[model samples]
Every structure is written in structure tokens, then in C-alpha cells.
Target: MSKIDLRKNIVQYMLERKQLAHISARVGIVLDITGSMQGLYKNGTVQEVVERILAVASKFDDNGALDVWVYDHEFSRLPAVTEQDFNSYVTTQILKNKNIHKFGRNNEPLVMEDVIKKYTVEEQSSLPAFIIFINDGGAVKSTKKVIVESAIQPIFWQFVGIGNSDFEVLKKLDSMEGRIVDNANFIHLEDISAVSDEMLYDQLLNEFPMWIQAATEKRIIR
Candidate 1:
């Protein structure tokens, strides 16, 4: 089989295993454009991530379009990426856009708020929203409030720390208190390239299915 077919099949199998093949969600990706992540952007690692994520969206997302956002101190929500237009998406949609706020400081809460609005307010879907957030480092305490508040919404935050940087704030996601349900999860990958696609998919999907069940039972999602 061809590469795209293989990718879709792999994701399909993962969904079936999780017993999540029957569910549909809206998928989004939040990428950190702070100075620390410049190397990943320049070397095409971020592009590879988009392709892998798009594969997951194809199987799980209702529309199969991965909503894209890149951020530094400010965030810009770019176009949604579908299978046909995902090639060179990061380079063309993000890096090439002079209007994008690129490579500066970290302000996770600003973009985190935008993600919540995009899924919970703007789209207003009963289906759950699955967001893959990629950050290199520079976690701040203020980001906690955003995640805590979003717990009641129909959104699940899956945070992926892609480097050896101290992701202190993110590490607290699972244990955070005052949330109706645990809406966030974090995973650290020192070297994303060293991990296989199956492993990555497993890690990403590990907590999501459980969250869906919990959210449904609690009426957070219908």
C-alpha cells in the first residue's frame, strides 16, 4: 500500500483499539513559535508533525480538517489543514506569512484562550474537541487558569513537550484541582523523531478515550 494509505490504516487501527472509532471530534493543533522552537520549524520537524496529526484527524475529526494555530507572545489562527493541502503547510501557511507573530517570548494563556473560543464558543459543537498542543519549553503559571476553566467545556487539551526544557507548569496538568473533569494531559518527548508512529499515536490517544467517557457521563459532551 502507499504511504497515505498506510498512515490512515495505522490511525484507524488505533481508534478501533481505543473503541473510539465510532466517535467524531473536531481536531486542532497549537504550535509554539517562541524562539526556542525555531530549529524545529527550520528543519522540517514541525512539518512532519503536521502530517502525522492530519492522519489522526482524518480518522477522528468530523470534518477531517486540522485547525492550525502558531504562537509566541501572540497567536494567529491560520487556515484549517485538510489532506490535499497539508503538504508544506507549516512552511507556506505559517513561516511564509509575514503577518504571523513568530519567534519571541512565551505566553501560553493567550493562545490557550483562543483555542477554547475556537472550539467551544465559535463552532459550538456537541462533539468533543481534541487539541494537540506542541510546546518546546517556557511554561508559565498563568496557563493553569486557562486549563482549569476549560475543564467544564467540551475540549480536551493534549500537551506535548518536545524538548528537554523544564515543562513545569505542564507537568501539573493531570493533578490540577478545581476542575470538574481532568481536561488536560501532558507528555514529554526528548526526541520526537526517535519515536515510532505507533508509539506516538498510543501515547497521544492514551488518555483521550477515557476523557471522552468521563466527559459524556458528566454531560460535558453530548
Candidate 2:
């Protein structure tokens, strides 16, 4: 399919699901660039997901752009991705040199800390933030600490595990103690392409609105 048509289909799918209809939060995409994800990046799975998520961000984010970060042992922000430049952006910034494969570790807490510090503690925007964190394996030990600490912030973490690897840490996040509220959700995708858009959207978004409401009651978000 042509890139334009693919983009349209993604937008249409999100609209049909009302994924962006009731939310007005900034969207951030935290992609795991570990070695395990090399196949997904090379096979265009990551590219397609980025495009679809950008469609939702365009409707919900005030800037109509997605703040992207790629993490391995650490993390760094990429240029903001929008529908118009997403194709060229990924080609030049991520796919051309196979940069996504360069990262060798999977320290998820670092990425979480960076986002929370930047968006919650520093900028302090009134609108809540929705963070889409994609990973294929478990995170470092520090991830639990960071996640529990982040429960008080105005952010919702949607964790998508894109492979068959055991996601023990993510699976136990909801039951972990000391969290102000359950601010994270995990969904495993064995075959990302085979998953229908409706199912993917439902899994990716199911717990976010509840977190928003809970965070508001706790004064994490205004």
C-alpha cells in the first residue's frame, strides 16, 4: 500500500475507535531500540506503528506532533514526528544507518526518568501526558523504582511488549506496592501486523482514561 493510503487508514481506524475523542494530552512515544527489536525496525513494523500513533497524537496533542525517544542503556529524544515528515524522518534519522540497532542495552527506567523529569517536574504543563512505551524484553531493576515514583506525576504509561519474550516486570507492575495508582498497562503482541487496528487500539488505550481520572483525584493533574 502507498504511504498516503496507509496513513489515511490509520487515522480512520483511530477515529472509528474514538481513541482521541475524549483526550487532550500531549503524546510521547518511547521506543525500545535494543537488539531484540532489530527485526521489527527492519521489517517496517515500527514505522507503521509510529505512523498510526502519530495520527492519534495529531488529534490529541496540542502541537499535533509526537515527542519520540529511543532507549537502550540510556535514552535520547528524536526530532518530533508528524504525519507530513514521518516517512522521511524515520528514513533519515532511524532507518538509513540502521541507528535503531546501535543501542545494545535495555534500561527502561532511564527513559521513564527522562520523560517524567522533562514533562512533569520541569515544564509542568496542565494537560496530562500519555506515554506509549514499546519494548520486547524486561527492563533493568531500576525500572520498578522509577515507575513507582512516577505514579504521582501527571503521566500514563502504556507498555506494549512486541515479541514473545517474558515481560515479568511489566506483568507485575499493576500489583506492585506503593504506587499512588496503577499508571501503567501492558499488552503483548506476538505478530504485530496480524493484530487488527481495533484490538491494538483497545489494548493500547484501555487503562489510560482511568489513570487520568485517578491522577486528577490525587492532584497529579489539574
Please tell me which predicted candidate would have the highest TM-score against the true structure.
Answer: 1
**Candidate 1 local lDDT, 64-100, one digit each (tens):** 8899899999999999999889889998999999999
Each prediction's number of clashing residue pairs: 0, 0
lDDT of each: 0.91, 0.79
Model 1 steric clash pairs: none
Each model's TM-score, in the order given?
0.98, 0.88
Please identify model 2 stretches exceeding 4 Å from their true place.
1-20, 97-101
Candidate 2, residues 97-140, lDDT tens digits: the string is 45444558888877788899879677788998898988888677
Instruction: Please give the lDDT score at residue 83 for candidate 2.
Output: 66
Quote model 1's TM-score. 0.98
Worst 10 residues of 1 by lDDT: 1-10
